[model samples]
Target: MVFLKVAPMKGVMRFGKKGKLSLRFVGPFEILEKIGDLAYQVALPPALSGVHNVFHVSMLRKYILNISHILNYESLDLREDLTYEESPIKILEKPDKELKKKKITLVKVLGRSHAVKVAIWEHEDEMRAK
Candidate 1:
């Protein structure tokens, strides 16, 4: 199995989110056959059917299995729109970030389940409005 390196073309597909948080690679796709000296055809999902299946070796990363992957398996409840929402159960911290120009007040919101935990920093004023 190998992960496909995503082509960073602007205004194209973002596997998950936009901006710097976008997905860099997708899948541990199976290699169907060797296409040439440096390329191989991969079995990509139906969602990626529009894309060419064949890829160069340099664009693929080998997947190495280990204990951590199995032990930490947690499913994200992604919606049909590919967005996942976890309501903030509590505010963990009130951190102040200082920039060269000014100071920004932030509140750290904690979202957690029995297995999965997520934290996000939000503007203190915006969070209060919400």
Candidate 2:
């Protein structure tokens, strides 16, 4: 018998809520389809373990606000529908070589925008609560 481990996730966002918007994952858009004005399913990676939920709008804003930096494109004419994913869980408690190698990477994806830019930086110690 084979037993596959399942992930624990919670409702990060909901409809009819203030500051709520739409977002999608760069991948898995097929397995998790969006039905226009409906919703899109997201699969959290291992790094996002223990994460409960996130604000759809805030998540979108993070990408939108950093568009200039991420895409290096000057013009916003390319309003391509894209998705961004970030781990909501906390890491760094256990410093493993593999986990360190697989450290959380801040990624940004813009649709049809090849010039899009993605930046990754180390989090401040204060940023991580003890």
Instruction: Give the Å error, residue 102, model 1.
Output: 34
Q: Count the backbone clashes (under 3 Å) in each candidate.
A: 0, 4
TM-score of each: 0.52, 0.18
Enumerate residue pairs that collide in model 1. Answer: none
Q: What is the clash count of model 2?
A: 4
The candidate maximizing TM-score is 1
Report the lDDT tens digits of candidate 2 across residue range 1-130. Answer: 1111222235555222222342332211112333345333344456555653222322321122333434444444433565433323333333323364566433222123334443333333423431
Best by lDDT: 1
Model 1 residue runs over 4 Å out of place are 10-13, 71-130
- The deviation in Å at residue 5 for candidate 2 is 27
Candidate no. 1 TM-score: 0.52
What's the lDDT of the predicted structure labeled candidate 2? Answer: 0.33
